[model samples]
Target: MPPKFGTSGLRGLVTELTDALVARHVRAFLAACPHGGALHVGRDLRASSPRIAAAVAAAARGVGVEVVDCGAVPTPALALASTGAGAAAVMVTGSHIPDDRNGLKFYTPSGEITKADEAAILAALDAEAAPAPAEGALREDAGCGARYVARYVEAFGTDALDGLRIGVYQHSSVARDMLVDLVERLGGTAVPIERAAGFVPVDTEAVAPETRAALPGWAAEHRLDAVISTDGDADRPMVADAAGRIVPGDVLGPLTARLLRAAIVATPVSSNTLVERMQPGFELRRTRIGSPYVIAAMAEALDADPAAAVVGYEANGGFLLGFEAPAPAGALAPLMTRDAVLPILAPLAAARAAGIGLEELAAALPARFTAADRLQEVPTDRSAALIAALTDDPEARAAFFDTGAAEAGLDLTDGLRLAFENGEVVHLRPSGNAPECRCYVEAASAERAEALLAAHLQRLRDRLG
Candidate 1:
């Protein structure tokens, strides 16, 4: 597979996610998402979303799949509704990536399109014909607004956030409405961020320096207990603390697990710097990087034990938890999939359940800093050559010399990994979506870790140059 799909969905630039490709993948994925249930469609505010989502809806209707077109909603709402209704769904969102890019997210009746399902969709693409468009009856459900908001209020109850304020930095997240509504439902004031006209891409890969710098002031001015936000599709979060400091996802992940007091399924690249920080009672299981990897592991674990309490999958700041009834063991577990809503609702509710500030809840976890840098735009022609060389060529590994890897004299774990003596690590992989190469490094101090990242980026650019 040359990868027409990426970590979450079938993604490509606006130009590359052509109508032909859009129609084919959507048709194949719907076939694989099972049949005879309703099909819902939703999308973000991306420029290319309408075209792609329309393509998906057309394909679904062609297959006689009943369509519920919930236009311009966050990815989570679409997922929640589909899963709740026992129907499959498709969402058009490029997530936190730049606006120049867009993609389609296919949902099974349960949650996101899984890896096995993706492979099935790809395989079906070869055998299927181009779907003829359908002129199905269209029903618009504006009630997604009220229903999605109610899930939060019901989860935490209105009393939890009695006097807190939340700063919603809505650069381009589809969850902007939900976050503000969640604040009001929780009895907190929702202060929207300052205006920025036009399509200002709000990807975590490119979070503005001003946003990071302004967090403290935003919190103080608003008397906010925290600032909450999601990526464009509303699948992940970018959160800040009461003191007005941006909280990295890696830091929040383990804290979320500890707070939930549930079993954790995390990616291996996660901050092992947290192993000692957790409460001795919690169980931690590490899997590969993708959400499917974590989700699959959770399914398997839960299969063996019906009273399972898998908290969340946190590779970065946006961790997800599962909360359901029957209380795993006299205590409630969270939702099934990784939800952007969990970071806001679960954490807030967990803190309220404990009667403490989020800061104090965070403080229970051992403190350590982690940083990541992406070495981007490594031409497509060079990605395989780089992946091949980094893995098989000792001569190529020599090129990263003086980067923390070469300086520390380390070797592989997953991709070209370099683990430092100082509880830090640098991991390298060619981009799963783009031509760019990626280097994810985290260390004890932001300055030192970021400095090391800068050096490594320069080293690779120089070597690959």
Candidate 2:
């Protein structure tokens, strides 16, 4: 398929994202959105990014929009800089997808473009507009990277992570070096490991089996208190505890929210249900999957209670701040976009201050575990058909689950989520960016959650593949 807007951004294969197509999208975005004279552009380390970024700059410049090239930086950092300047921004990255694929994330001065904004851009794609009187000037933003690093250090305190040995699994994330800098600047000893020479598609939501198996060994070899990394674009976080066990994003989301003392939290339905049990006092809003939906919910929460401290996070571990809240060292400004650094640093800092290990801090929460995996190369049509069958027909659901127990309830918020009488849950949804069907399961224990996910995914493969 040609590059089209998915749950997060415009995504498709690299071959389909030609210069002409990329330029058209950029022009369409500029025409549809209101912004200042300047637009900021940033990219990831993928081989295809530089070319796409150049196309984006050219297209904006052609329209009289001054281009501020932010170079290779995290997606959130680009958003922070552009929004700070009261300008729109574009990030050239495929996020967690494979390198053969690339995409563009658009942001207005406010934050990530909402679903309404996506429709506006599509409607403006074919509309004619006069060219600028002259080409706009191009400039480099050399300070955005440092400014991003300073944001966390200043708010969370320079010694927030004192006496902690943190391992940074650099891989090929564009924020690899930046992550190390943040850790060291916060008084933690950062041991960089497994730095890759080229791009690595690290999906925080569904980490590769090999990487999961290697985390423990890395921890043992280095005596690490924890290991942290991010996806290609550095918006989603991946964290492993002291024993080298990877922590689920849902777990991290609630923990970080609690640490931030969030009064109102907005999270996708795919996140762990334990949030309600752990933080009953906080007003919670359950939204459909995707950052756009969560951000919208945060906005609604703020509207209902203007004094509330609003926060948003996804099961993928990307945290969004909806208000300027108090941190241990200072006040943090609102950044209503998916961010990896805050979630990663906040939890680590809390654990350090509490005089406990990351694992201990997690153990204090309600024990609800979640596991997710995907069946790749499964077409969206097939996935929709299967879920429709199960959703509409009781016989189909009974035959598929084979649990011999009635469902406690069913939620069609974003996908087909079935809650069983035994308190187990199975949720299936088609991947928004690629040809894949994602499955998520939850249970009282990690082993049960994992087994449920494995069995259901195998069933999907048998039926769809």
The C-alpha lDDT values of all candidates are 0.68, 0.91
Worst 10 contiguous positions by lDDT, candidate 2? 398-407
Most TM-score-accurate candidate: 2
Model 1 lDDT on a 0 to 1 scale: 0.68
Per-residue C-alpha lDDT of model 2 across residues 1-465, encoded as one tens digit per residue: 567898879999999999999999999999999768889999999999999999999999998999999999999999999999999999999998888999999999989999999999999999886769999889999998899999999999989999999999999999999999999999999999999988898989889999999999999999999999999999999999999988888888888888778988899889998888984557789999999999999988888887779999998999999888788899899999999998898889999999999999888999988999899877788998999989999888878874346889999998899999988899999988788899988898989888888889889988998
Give the poorly placed runs of model 2, Cα more than 4 Å off: 402-404
Residue 449, candidate 1: Cα error in Å is 2.5
The C-alpha stretches of model 1 lying farther than 4 A from their native spots are 1-3, 129-136, 275-277, 322-334, 349-357, 380-384, 393-414
The candidate 1 region of ten consecutive residues with least summed lDDT is: 325-334
Candidate 2 local accuracy as lDDT?
A: 0.91
